[model samples]
Every structure is written in C-alpha cells, then in structure tokens.
Target chain A: MGKVLMKGNEVLAEAAVHADCRYYFGYPITPQSELVAYMARRLPEVGGLFLQAESEIAAINMVYGAASTGVRVMTSSSSPGFSLKQEGISYLVGSELPAVIVNIVRGGPGLGNIQPAQSDYFQVTKGGGHGDYHIPVLAPSTLQEIVDLTMDAFDIADKYRSPVIIMGDGMLGQMMEPVEFKEKVESKQFDKSWATTGTRGDGGPKIITSLELDADSLEKRNTLLQKKFAEMKEQEVRYETYCTEDADYIIVAYGTVARIAMNAINKARETGLKIGLIRPISLWPFPEKPFEETRKRVKGYISVEMSAGQMIEDVRLAVNGHAPVDFYGRTGGVVPTQEEIYEKIITVAGGLKYEHENGI
Target chain B: MLQEIIIAGFGGQGVMSMGQLIAYAGMIEEKNVSWLPSYGPEQRGGTANCAVVVSDQQVGSPLVSNPSAVIVLNNPSFDKFEPKVRPGGLLISNSSLVARKSEREDIKVIDIRATDLANELGNSRITNMILLGAFIEYSKFLSENSIIESLKKVLSEDKYHLIDINKRALRKGAELVAVF
Candidate 1:
C-alpha cells in the first residue's frame, strides 16, 4: 500500500485496529486526545468497541475487564491522567491481565503544561503503582516506529500476560509525517485456555483476581512474578546505536529527544568531533549492554532528556563509574534546541580531554 | 540539502495547513518530511505557527529554531519570525495585512499581497494558498506540480469544488514573486 500522511496519534490508533485490538478505553487529555478521538470514530466501523469512561481511573479498569476476557484491549492518556490510571494499572499487573497502555507524555509536577516531555520516565519504568513488579515499556521516536510499536505492544503484552506501555511525548503525538502501514502479522497464538471467559464447555470455573490475602501465597506469587521479569530482562532488551564506533563521546536519549540529539550528533560530527547516540527502544529493559560495551572507548556520556535528569541515573548505574556521565536537559515543557545540545557536546568532549591530560 | 521553514499567521489564517501542504508535497516527491505545529493554548485565537522540515536524508529534529525560510501572514507573525531566518534565508510575507517590510539586511524578503489577491479572487480564505504559492516559487524546495497534486489529496472530496480557485491563487502568488 502507498504511504499516507498521518498524525502520530491518529496512526497509532489505526495501527492498534490493524493489530486486531478490538477494544479501547480512554479519557480526554491534550496531545493524546487525537488517539481517543480516532478510536471513537474508527473502532465502531470495524466491529470493535470504543468507550470514553468517566475518567482515566474508570478507563483503565475497563481495559482490565476487557483484557481478562482474553481480548486485545488498550487505554491511553497523558501525565496527570496517567497518574489517575496508576491504581488500575497496578491491579492489572497484579491480576496478570494483558493490555496495551499508551502514555503520550506532557510536562508535569501538577498540571504543568500541554507540551512534549520525558518527565514520566521514572514514573513508568520504575512501576508507577504500588507493586513489586515491572511492565515492559516501549518508547518510539518516529511516527513509523509509533505505528510499529503500537501493533507490537499488543503481542508483547499477550506474550507475557502483562501490560506494555507505549511512551511518546506531545511532539510525537501531534506531528504529521509520512507513514506506510505494513500488512498485519499473523496473530500469535496465546494460551487463553486459562481465561475467565465463562465456564461454558471444558475447563471448570476460573477466578481472575489479584487479591491474595494470605501472606505465604502472596510471597510465592511475587517470586514467580520476579522470575517472569527476569526472563523479560534477558529476552527483551532493545536499542538503536548510531555512529558509536571510535567515538570520543556518547549521547544517550530516547523518544523525541533522541531525534533532536541526532541533530546534535550530526552537527558535532561535521566539526570533526566523534559523537554518537544510543536510543533506548525499551525503557523497562533499559538497554545497558551498549553503555557497558562503549564505556571503555568513550571519554564520557551525555544523557539528554526532556526532564531534569531522571534517565541519567540509569546511565550512571550502567556506566558504574567507568567514565563520567553528564546530563543536559530541559524541564517544564521546554525542548532543548539542537544548537544547545551541540554546544554541550563540544564542551563535555573538551572537558573530558582536559581531565584525561591532567590525570584527574 | 535540508530546507526548514516556519509558517506563521493568525489562528484562522490556515497557517497549519500551509505547513502540512509543504510537508506533504515534499513526501510526494519521495523526500523525508516532518510538520510540527505550536499546539498550545495559544492556538485557539492567537498567533499560530508550524515548523516544516524537508530533506533528502533523514530529518533529525522536527523543531526548526533557525529556518531556511519563513512565511508570515500577519504583522505579528512577521515581526516574531523574521529575525529567526538564517542569514541567507528567504522570507515570504503577506503584504496585505503586514504593512511594514522586514528590516533584516541579510535575508531575502518577498512581499506578496496574498489577502488582497484572494479577495480579488472572490475568496479570502485562500490567502494561505496564495502565500504558499509565493513560498514555493521563492524557495523552489518542491516542484509546483508536486504541490498541486498534493493539494488534490489533502483536500476532501466535498471541498474539491474550490480546487480551481486555489490553483489560481497559487499561480497568482507565484506570478507576483516572478515579477518581483
């Protein structure tokens, strides 16, 4: 099929439908409203269900209910709205329900502004709700990636029977770009034999609840969940490397910020500087392998983000004092300009060289 | 080569559509394109703007801080964005609403009376199309034919009746640039 010009939010909605996700629940939030609006209009035509719940809290619970029925379900919101959905998300996690949740993030501490931001990094990757578990998080930088990830999110959620979060910022949700939707992949066959789809034929009644009241049983369940998370960590780490070989410095960023960092990298390269970029595709898995491998060769790492240094802590943990890790970011709904990033790269690179010469 | 442009105007002046059309035309030409609008509270009834980037290679940032060209449809937009154009960049302004000329000596500025021409053409809404026509002619980033074809796709079928006037307005804007 030919490529079509589409907004990122609208394309994400279309991709979800193409992925055979027949149920969607969401509330209205800036930047992410287009996704809900698109679903409201398109889902009904495809024999699917689209519901706008009274609030984000209700929307996520609806997703939980639908997912428990062994059907593909999804919900999306921005920062504040997403915070409201946290309780339901934790329940979905504890219940082992498969669902796709999208957070087209905006700046916030409390209704900060309606602009793109990466402030939700810690909130999302660290398990927002009260739980001893982790959800696989996918951050997409481009519109095409958004479509591909939205489709894959459903499968990923079903594969582990866990909710997968697709994280994007306001820019990704609002921008328009050319995208070609691929032919749908053959749906993966998941074992829904244990689903709570009513005790009709063969299997007897099955209960779908996260309430383990007993301490011993809860601990056992927690151990098993930990095992699943470990398995995911081993199998699901994904990242993209650009111009990292023989580089003096590496810039780590994700989502919209990564794209801007690419511009900085290219600019620095034009000035005969060796700068590279490591874009984390999966935030939960948090591709640490790149940093571990590149730490010895590079002088330092620059963690660029739209927040005030949340992901930098992850980079520091990965680096483990092998090299100095610097942070450059903008908060409160402001995006760092390309020139600003490039200047930082030059200053950091020069500072690293000076420190090496002085043996500091 | 990468061409970054900022199209700015009042809320109802179709500033966003102008950027979308340019980006779509670039895509039709098989180039990488991105269009990002200023989608804040100010978009309701205030000055609106969008940034468009077209390149043969992958476009890194969709936000254009320093643009290669700018299209301003109002006095406020012209005053705000005229200084942000690169030294050797191009500026296309709607002279009908904006009475003052850009004072920048480094950049090339082309003033087209798009609103007046659109009024003469019996439709004031196509002022953006006229300014877009001038922008394309001045910048030559995308072929005129490609832009016209893109318009056919961007406009809904019910709105196809106005295609003729839009085309005329585009051509008129281009002619104004040529004469200058």
Candidate 2:
C-alpha cells in the first residue's frame, strides 16, 4: 500500500467503499459531514446506496433496514447526532445486527463546541443507547487507523453479530493523514441464513425484531449475545504500549489523548521520568491484560483523556487496586498538550493521592 | 510512515481538490494516506484547510502543528503559519495572498502567483494543482511520472480532457521552483 493523504472522515467513507459496503445512511453533522459528502460522491461510482436521511434517527433506522439484508452498511454522526442514533443502536444490538456506527465526537454534555472532545466516553462505552447490551468499540487516534478501523468495525460487527463503533473525536475526523488503501480484502458475505431476507420454501419471510416477547427465548438470545461479547473481550482487545518495561509511570489513555501521551512519554524519557503509555486501541473490550501486567512494576497510573474522566474507571478496574490510580483531564474540546501531561505525571508520581473526591 | 498535510483556502480556489490530488499521488506511490477537510460549520463560510501528510514512517500523530512545509494561498494563512515553519522548510506563498515581506531568512520562501498563473491559463481553479506541482518538485518524494499516472487514474474515468491543463500547471510550478 502506498501513501495517499486523506482526511479522517473522507478516509472512512473511502474505506467503506473499498470494503464493499453497500449502504450508507447519514445526516450532515459537524466534524463528520465530510464523511457523508464523500459517500454521496463515491457511493454512486461503486454502484452503492447513499442516502442523507431526514434526521439522525431516520439515518440510523435506514442503516438498520440495510443491515438486515446482510449487506455491509454504515452510518456516521457527530456527538449530538450520535446521541440521536442511540435508540437505533440499542435496537441493532438487540436484533443482533451487524452494522458499523461512527461517532466523531465533539465537545459536549449537550450541544457542546464543534471542536474535538472525548466527553462521550461513558456514553459510548457504557452503552449510550440503552439496555444491558455492549457494543464493540474501536478508538482510532490517527487518520490511518480511522480507515483501518472502519473496515475492521464491519468485520468485528459481523463476527459478533452486533453493532461496532469506530469512536473518534472531531480532531481525529478532521485531521488528514497519508494512508495507503491496500488492496482491499474480499468483502466477506454472510450466509443470509439468519438475515431478515424473505425465506425460501422452508419458511415464510424472516422477521427481524429486537423485541422477544417470550421471556425464555429473550434470555436465551441475551445469553448467546453475552457469550459472543465475552468471546470478543478475549479475542478483540487492541492496544499499543510504549516504553513500559522499565517505566515508573504508566499513563493510560485512549483515542486522541493517547497520542499526546505517547509524545509526552517520549519527551519525559529525555528528562528521566521513565514514563510509558498504554493506549487502548479498542476502548470497550478495554484492553485490561496489559494494565494488569504493568501494575506490578509501575509505581502509579494516570488515566488521561480529553473528557473529565471516563475511561479512568476502567483503568482502576483493570489495575484492581494494585497500583495508585489517578485521573487528570480537560474538557469542552480542550486537548491537553504534552507539557500538561508531563506535569500530571510528576504530580501523580510525587505522592499526590487521587482520593475518590468526585463520584463521577 | 505517513506524512499528513492540511491545505486550506476558500471554496472556489481549488485548495481542497488539490489536496485530494496530492493524496492520490501518494496512494499511487504506495503509502498509507488520508485527506480530511474542515467541514460543516467551520467550512461553510470562510477559510478552508485540508491536512496532507506524506511520510515513510507509520503516521502516529496526524494533527500537524508546525507542518513540514506550508503552502499559503492567502495572507491570513501566511500570517498565521509563516513563523510556524520549521527551520530549512519551504514556505510556498502565493504572491496574491502574502504581500508582506518575509521576516525569516533561514527558510526557503517561493513566491508564486498561482492564481494569476491559473488565470493566465484561462482557469483560476488550477492554482491548487499548480501549488501541488511546486510541492511535488520541492519535496521530490513523489515523481512527475507517478503524479501524472495518479492524475490520469483520477481524471480518466470522467473522460475529462482538462487534465492536460492541470499537467501544465503542475509542470510550470515545478519549473519555477526547480532552481530555488
């Protein structure tokens, strides 16, 4: 694969085409609007369907309709629009549908700035839509990963028969990077046996619904879904580790903040901090194994994120009280620089204990 | 490795399209690449920027602060980014955008009237292509043949004959900057 520069949003759109994604339904949203624009122009060239639905709700439902046919389908939105898609996402999960949903997050508790923000951390990881279901989430920091992960999302969704989200912030979506679209893998088609397509002579049309009125049957399906999710946790944890072997501080972060932490670790290495970074490439499965390993040697851990502190809880859970856990962050679309992270490292390592003062 | 760059300008000036072309060249040369634009609210009314990075190493941080090189199409961008260029980097400024004299002596500054050249060529939209031409020539990471091949690949499908003009724009920019 050769280098071609593309915006993160545009790359997702192009990769979707290359992945043989047949249907795309999305509304215009900041930081992710380019994705829809790219799909609008390119989908027709590939003989695919691209629809700008009336609303985010309609868009996600459109994706639901398309995914039911067992074809590659996708929808993307920014923070607020993504919020609107949650209901559909829950439905997608309940139905065990395979679809790729993208959340190019922006600053917000509600309708925040258009700039980048990871505030949707809990919303995305804790199941933003509803119910007790978990969605497979991939957090990409760079543009290359955006393309790679979009294609991977489709694969993971199908493998688990669930909705997979490539959760990126505005910065990741808006930034451009040189990405080589390698010879695309052959689009793996499903058996259509379980798809809601009209049945053959053996049975009538298959009904695809999230609702299971039968209590026993719903439990059985939930058990199956839970089993699939458990399998994903074992098989689908993705992370990147930098200079942790002899490090005293292990900084844990994911998505965009993780990139900055890596840079901070590099800078701190020169100053003899012996800092390392554990970046969760896959946020939901949450990459617990590495943190469990690093907890023994590392003196303390700080979970850095753009949001107030969402993934920090997962880090503490992963470490299981083995090491001192702390949290430091900036919200409302402010990206913490390497210097800020370095300062936090010093603060955490300097015996400043992180008591659970704020419950959230 | 991936090198990403953001090329920004107003909508009609072809800044965004040129970004796509440069990225395409990079792809033809077999490097991992992505092209992102400032869309929605930010891009609706005002300056537009496209980030482009071409690199031989796996791209880690895609947000380019102090870019390797800057091709400024207007004064606001020049004022905004002139000081940010790393030492010994090229600052390709469209003379129309940057009328102010450069204060830095260490950096290479090429003043090209890309819009004027495009107007002279009977199409103002080719300025971005011209700038891309200069970028390719100065950078040398991508060759003319590869760029042309990529151009043909992007343009041939549309049966558009205007690629010859874009090729001319690319060559002129390359020729103007070769001696510098």
Candidate 3:
C-alpha cells in the first residue's frame, strides 16, 4: 500500500469503512465534523448507509437499533456531543451489542471552544453513563495508529459482543499525516444468532434487553457481564514502552500527550537522565504491567496529559506507592509544549542530575 | 534532520495549502511528517496558521512553539511569529503585505514581494507556493520533483491545469531566495 497525506478525522472514517462499517450515524461538530461529513460522502459509494441524525442522542440511538441487526455500525462526535450519546452508549452495553463510538475530545465544562483536550479521560475510562459497565476504550496517538486502532475497535467489539470507544482529542482529529490504510476485505465473521433480525421458529424469538424483572436473573446477568469484562481486560490489554530497560524516571502518558512525552524523553536522555515512557494504547485496561516493571528501580513517575489530572489517578493506582507518582498537564484546550514537559521531568528530578550508576 | 515550520497568514492566503504542500512532499520523500492547523474561529476572525513538522525521525508534538522556519504572508502574521523563530533559523515574509523588513539579528530573513510577484504571474493564489519554494531552497527539506508529485495528490483533478503555474511560482520564490 502507498502512503497518502490525509486528515485524521476523514482517514478515521475511511478506516472504519475498510473495516466494513456499512452503517454510520453521527452529528456534525468541530474536529469530528470532518468524519461525519466524510462518512456521508463515502458510505454510499460502498453501498452503505450514512445518516446525519437530528441530534447526537438520536444518532446514538440509531446506532443502538442498527447494532441489533449485527451489522458493522458506528458513530462519532466531539466532546459535548459525545456526552449526549452517553445514555445510548450505556444502553448499547447493557444490551450487549457490538457498536463503535468515537469521541474526538475538546475543551469543556460547557460549550467550550474547539481545541484539543484530554478532559474526558475520566468520563471515558470510568464509563460515562450510569451503571457497573465498562466499554473497551482505545486511545491512539498518530493517524497511523488511529487507522490500526479503529479497525481493532470494530473487531474487539464484534469478538466480545460489547460496545467499544475510540478516545481521541481535537488534536488527533484535526491533524494531518501520511497514513497507509489496511486493505478492505469481507467482514461480518461473527455469529448473529442472537440478533433481532427475526425468529427462525427453531424455538422462539430471542429476547434482547437489559431489563430483567427477576432478581436472580438480573444477578446472574450482571455476573456474566462482569466475567466478560474481565476476559476483555485479560486479552485486550495493549501498551508500548520506549527506552524503559533500566529507567530511573518513567513518564506515563497516552494519546496525543504520549507523543509529546516522547519528545521530552528524547531530550531528557541527552542530558544524561535515564528517562523512559509508557504509552497505553488501551485506556480502559490501563496497562499496569509497565508501571510495576519500571517502578521497581525508578525514582519517580509523572503523568503528562492535556487534563488537570485524570489519568494520573490511574498512574498512582498502578504505581501503588512503589515510586512517587506526579502529574503535569494543561487543561481548557491548551496543549503542553515539549519544553514544558521536559521542564516537568527536571522538576520531578528535583533539579539534581542523575549519577552514572552503571556508566553506559 | 528535523524541520519544524510555521506558515501563518490570513484565512484565504493559502497558508494551509502551503503547509500541506510541504507535508505531502515530505511524505513523497518518505519522511515522517505531521501538519496541524490552528482551527475554528480564528480562521474567520483575523489570521490562520498551520504547523508542519518534517523529520527523519519520528515526529512528536505537532504543535510547534519554537519553529526552525517561519513564513508570514501578512503584517499580523509577521508581528506575531517574527520572534518565535529559533535562533539561527530562517524567516520568509511577503514584503508586499508585511512592511517590517527584518527585526531579528539572530535568524536569516528573506523578505520577498510574493503577492506582487504572484500578481505578475497572473494568479495571486500562487503566492504561498512562492514562499514554500523559498523554504524548500533554504532548508533543502524536499526536492521540487517530490513536490510536483505530491501536487497531483492535493489538487483536484479539475484544477490540474494550474499545476504548471504553481510550479513556476515555486521556482520564482526559490530564485529570489537563492541570492540571499
């Protein structure tokens, strides 16, 4: 395959199209506006359906209903619009449907301006809607990773019969890069016997609902869902480590912030600081293995992000006081400069240079 | 080698397309590249800008603060990004719209009357290609042939007729910067 210079949002829509997402329902918003627009233009060429629903709520509900038929279906939006789709997402999970939702996060508390932000970290990782449910969350940094992970999101959703979320920021959505897409192929490799297509009369119509009137049945259902989530945690954990062989200082970051931390890690290494990084591709599973492996001989861990301190909580939990866990971030649509992150590492080191322990 | 560049101008000055040309050329040369634009309200209000990072290594932090090169097409863009260029970096400005000739002694500055020259070439839209051409000559980041190959990717098929003029504009800008 040859590389093409493409925008993140448009390429992401095509990424799903290649993964056989034939049904797309979404509302237009900044950053992710391009994705919905791309889907509207490209889906029909592939003999698919693209709907610009009246509202994000309506779009998500459309996804929920289409997903009942066991089709490759998905929707996308920015920060505030994503919040509107939370109830539908929770409903999709409760019903155990395979659906993909994308949130290209932006600044917010209200209708904040359009710029990159990671403020939705806790909302996405902790399950935005009400319930004891968790959606498989994939966080990809670059456009190439976005293509790879968007395809993975659909597969993970179908394989587990659970909802999936692609957590991206405005930066990831708006940026452009050279990306080579995976080749398109025939999909729908999962069994849809439990779908609501119709009754085959083998026994009777299958009932698909989160509502269970019987207390014992509800308990059993919840236990089954928990076990499924546990399996996802065990099998779907994805992470990458950079120069962490014998690191004294480790930075924990994900998505766009992870790339920024790499710049800092590279610079810090030049000054004789043993710095490394852990980039968690799957945000929900929270890649705890890297923290345990590096914190053994590390002096400190800093979580860099575009939020006040959401992922830092997960970092703290993963470190478990094995090493000092610190945070450095900027909220409200501002991206942290690489120099600021390098300074954070220096501050975390208490301005003291590391001694050459095993002089490499 | 890494080239962190900022292309800033008014909304319709081809600032984004200029950045895209460089990025696409970088991709043609098989280099790691990222192009991030300052999106939303600013495009409608006053100025528009985009950051381009072309690197031999992996590109990180697409938001470039200290740029290795800056090309400003208007006075406002000049005022804002003139001092942001790295020491010993390069600054290329459109002298027709930007009145400030040079302000920094640390960096090499090339002020070309891009708008005037583009007008002479009968299409003011090619003004950005001129500045882009000058940057290409100065940094040697990507070849003109690679840029021409990528032009076929960015321009719609209907506008294929303008590729030759855009190529001429790039050459004009490169010629102006060759002496400086």
* Top-DockQ structure, candidate number: 1
Expressed as tens digits, the lDDT of each residue in A257-298 for candidate 2 is 887687667767887778888889998899988887889888
Question: Can you write out model 1's per-residue Cα lDDT over A215-298, one digit (the tens) per residue?
Answer: 999999999999999999998888999999978999999998999999989988988999999999999899999998999878
* TM-scores, each model vs. reference: 0.98, 0.81, 0.97
Name the candidate that leads on lDDT. 1
lDDT score of residue A3 within candidate 3? 88
TM-score of chain A of 1: 0.97
**C-alpha RMSD values across all candidates:** 1.8, 4.4, 3.1
TM-score of chain A of each: 0.97, 0.95, 0.96
Q: Cα lDDT of all candidates, in order?
A: 0.91, 0.81, 0.90
lDDT of 3 by residue, A58-84 (tens): 999999899998899999999999999
Measured with DockQ on alpha carbons, how good is candidate 1?
A: 0.90
Better of 1 and 2 by TM-score: 1
Every model's DockQ = 0.90, 0.33, 0.85
